[model samples]
Target: MEFLELPKRTSGNRTYGLTSIIDLGTPTEDLKNILNDYHHIIDTAKIGFGSACVTPNLKKKIDLYKEYHIKPYCGGTLFEKCYYQKKIPEYLTSLRDLGIECIEISNGTLNIPMQERLNIISQIKKDFHVIAEVGSKDSNQEMPISEWKDEMKLLLEAGCDYVITEGRDSGTAGIYEKDGNIRSNLISELIKDIDSKKIIFEAPTPKHQMYFIKEIGANVNLGNVKLTDVLVLEAQRRGLRSETFYLEDRECKLPL
Candidate 1:
């Protein structure tokens, strides 16, 4: 069976164009089934929020994700809780015990000072693949573009593998408006200075996914995606869906 031609996507152990699935609490068995089919498209899986601490068969699940070549790590909220409680060592120890190779260091919900955050990243980079997130999870705490850029630059220099712009799992905070629309000006200012390849935009909803794929090309790194949407997001990336059907090698090929 011949497959129809469409836009080409970055494939195999991707670094730039990554699809990071947010696992809110998918059963281990169900995750195994999904990964059997979609593992090739999934670059990483974030055990969203603090669910990693309470999830059943967590080590098994983490090992399973690793077996499928998916990098599994707890969400930043867990780190925030640990930081707030002054248990950073315990947190890192727990991650190591679970055979996790990656971790997200974020201050989305907490007020960890900028220098402190950078110090943590600098120290943690030696032990794990660090993904540092910027922006507040609270909608009212809007950050200026200059601060966003400054923080992102410092995070990267502090040795972060990637910097995630917070859109939360709801798509209603951080880079999004209350109604879930993207803040275009923020994105424009972001990519103008920062390398798009090094930033992960949290796009949990279909519309958000479509917007990023269309606006940032097929290879944009997206996070907080629901497990069920992996194939759908991949389809969008490849222009197999109507929303991105006109994409040709990352360029729009509209009917003339």
Candidate 2:
């Protein structure tokens, strides 16, 4: 029997409807299994935190991802470590050697100067696709909405391919509150001034993903998703899951 079709979504290469899953050092064999089953839904794979630094057979794993047409890149924390340790050049070289064409530049853990961050984006944009993240990972540090908008604009102008809204792995830091609830007002204000298509919201949890799909439309760019949740999130996006099944109703209209 034929399955019900999903709402139209952009192609995997398109700027919108992208889902970036985190590769938190899964074993190469398991990663291959995941890619084999869900590569079509996975647009990008982020080697989370500093796991890329310690994962064995790193090059082989990266190669596997590339073979499956999944864009893989190191997480922003790795960039912060390299930047603070004065190893930016070396880091870039090593990434290239490992066949990583995309890179995430974030100042979540490091207090990188704005000018320096822009400079780094500019430099890296020449050799790699840049995903610049805006926001502090520390829950205690709250940035004004105006500042968040300004930073996102600066990062885009500085040549970042896409700007990421910082939501840590737990979905409790950055754009989210300590309890993992999204700061809806702040996000609304930020998106009002910026293009939603250019922003990848890090929604690690099912609830967060469902919320974005309902609030921002089906094609919202979401990131920091766990490897196993890739297909599940796609199901929600397609109104295949109970939480979002109402989307399939002909008379239902989404909130503006």
Candidate 3:
């Protein structure tokens, strides 16, 4: 069935316009069913928060995501937990044994200094694809725009494949206001000098998704998405959804 033209999107192992879903303990059978239907559009699946440490059949889930070429990784909070517990080596070994290929290193909750964090990223980069997150999970703690850009630059230079802004799965912190609204000025300022392609904005709501698709174009990398929202998000990205019905034309602006 040939369809009408829609917004162009990179497909099959996409580098841009990535949709990273948060898998917070969906059963293996259920995950298989969902992946069977929507895996092609899912670039990565994050086991939300510290849930990966206790999820039964963890390796099976990781293997399934890998089978579809979707990068599977535990959330950064889990890494913080491991680091605090002085089990960083054990954590990495367990994840490697589980067939995981990518890792997210973040200081969202911990106070790991920039130099130490960089050193950690340097070490981790040798074994896996590293994605560093920059921002505090605390809403009251506002990082200056310059600091955000500076840290992101340093992380990318340290060999992180991408840098993620800390918008928690709830969508009520980090890049967002407490009420779940985006800080448009902050986004504008941060992207003024930094590359949006190297950052994955944690957009977990329909509004967030539409805003990014309209403002940053269809190729914007979005994370912390719910499993149920996958198809609709993809539709929105393609301008098939009414919120972004005109995105095919608007997306030409690119990498703002």
Candidate 4:
């Protein structure tokens, strides 16, 4: 079968349909070089794992990413830890000073109640384009698929720009099995009535990315992706790689 035609999203300076890269402490200069080389290919850049708090030159780094037209967001875990320690308002203020226009709101590490989570979503969007996460960091802590669906419905309705499923940085927690594979039964359930376009699946591992593509197709929204993999990830998204090569090869086997 020939490849399916996927709709193209607006590139650069886009509000939605974005492909983001997680910069998990890539050295400042190297990050600049990557952005200089591939800025057109990256829609968003994240200073990963709260590494920002100690990165020393965050303001300069943010300035560089901004120069390349990449919007940077704070890593959610850092935000949550500060919030739990009663420093959320301070954290937001600091992020603003650093020129962050996007903020990720997630309770992946801290156990924030529903009402409070929704409030955080509402409050953040009032000042920034909020990206909310819907799962937990602990692998043993499983939320019913129903809860995830409800959260997605509410987060988008609550004025969040996107709802990211908490696939964690490893992609082996939450909905994924220990082998880093997506549990189809669970995924199907979560997306039953949800819009895939508004979701950002945390498929950090390549196998998880492959599974999502093979099972859900190219348009699935992915997040927490490593910076070095941005080109390859986009290649996989555009079906320019061998993962789609066999599908290309199959044309020769078909009857004319």
Candidate 5:
């Protein structure tokens, strides 16, 4: 069965080649079905935009994700909401009660001072694994490349387990222009200065995913992938799809 050769991919739980899927009100049954088929390839599942706060079967979903060894966490907006409302202790307790061990800390919508953000990350690291997201959600609020690099470094140094580049669920903000075009120069600068493996780029669209796969190789860490696109993304990573088919050597002959 091991007939075709392809570049090696890190194991699912490993730090590299991570794929973080988004759970935006996916029904429990639908989510279970997806996990039943593709759990092995998914690294994390983010409960999108405070959905976990309102989803009736949040605990059930969290338990299912844990059973499959997938880290489940609330979206950053939920964390921001709790923080601004001065309910962080309650938020952490709720997460614990829900059997969630991971959380995202981001200031994409609310502008928390950088030092304060780092302090929050440090505090959160004590009880939960933190995935610190950098970049603004506002399409017009472009940040200088230096600031991006610095913030990423600071988050990592502040004890964040991973750093996520801001690509809103729509894939039209943060690293992408309003038209969904990537800021290639900014990304290039970040890659040049930071460890690509330590950062996850949110690529919600096929075009964005293809660009990252081709530009950063098949093992790039990607996030915000839709549940339906999980298998498709895996195909692209293995060069089974047209966009990456050239990654394999066509000239090689298989044994008859």
Candidate 6:
């Protein structure tokens, strides 16, 4: 019922909806504070790129994150370690043991073959609400738009809940340029090939979010968002401010 105003926008408890925050080396108390202040605005939390593996209070605070109804998931880097250590089973178990049910399987840092990548997706989808990323972290590691389209297709066929377009934290890979803006033609091309509903574009900057909202409408799934930017992104999503008011016009809607 809450989504009636925007049927494309699914509410909380959904596999797809809202902005996902990345907690990169943040303390448990800080995470708790965010939940306290912005519980309703936040959705998923990534214990950021395997740094959760190094945090002292990660296990103890995991339940607290769950208590707030925010689904917690390990970053793809953590999965990579488990994948390389030949311990994906244990890795997935550890994540589930810690009360996490969402996961991101990525080849951003490591070089994983397509069949192996497909296998990983196949296994993870059995339990976790899975999100698969399709790109390398290195700026020079360019995935041709055509190849990315094919990869996205395979990931979808493999039963991934969401597919990330590999916009690294800096918003400088794939369709994004070095200054955190998107490449228009590239965005058009990707949108034409990949179904937008099942894809999350990594938009780490306000400018990037604006471009994405203008280009793709409000339900664009954005990831790798910094913890502090959570509220800002929420406002932008709702067009509650000047930054995104023009977005409503872009969508051919009358001003609120």
Give the per-residue lDDT digits (tens) of candidate 4, residues 84-199: 78998899889889989988888888888878888887777778988888888888887888888888898899998888888777887777776677768877876668777777
For model 1, the superposed segments whose C-alpha errors exceed 4 Å read: 1-3, 250-256
- Higher-scoring candidate on lDDT, 2 or 3: 3
lDDT of each: 0.91, 0.88, 0.89, 0.76, 0.87, 0.77
For candidate 5, the lDDT comes to: 0.87
Which pairs clash inside model 3? none
Tens-place lDDT per residue, model 3, 1-256, is 3478777777887887799999978999999999999999899999998998789988888899999899999999999999999999999898889988899999999988999989988888989999999999999988998899999999999999999999999888889999999998999898788888888999998889888888888888999999999999988988888888887744545542
| Rank ordering of all candidates by lDDT, starting from the highest | 1, 3, 2, 5, 6, 4
Q: After superposition, how far is residue 17 of candidate 3 from its true place, in Å?
A: 1.1
Error of 1 at 247 (Å): 0.5
Q: Write the per-residue lDDT of candidate 1 for residues 1-100, one digit (tens) a residue.
A: 1477776667888887899999999998988999999999999999999998889999999999999999999999999999999999999999999999
Q: Stretches of candidate 5 above 4 Å error?
A: 248-256
Query: For every model shown, what is its TM-score relative to the native structure?
Result: 0.96, 0.94, 0.97, 0.88, 0.95, 0.89
The predicted structure with the larger lDDT, 3 or 4, is 3
Query: Alpha carbon lDDT of residue 121, candidate 2?
Result: 78
Each prediction's number of clashing residue pairs:
0, 0, 0, 0, 0, 0
Residue 52 displacement in candidate 6 (angstroms): 1.4
- The parts of candidate 4 lying over 4 Å away from their true place are 1-10, 15-17, 246-256
Q: Residue 5 in model 6: shift from native, Å? A: 11
* Residue-level lDDT for 110 in candidate 1: 96
Q: Candidate 5 deviates by what RMSD?
A: 4.0
- What TM-score quantifies how close candidate 6 is to the native fold? 0.89
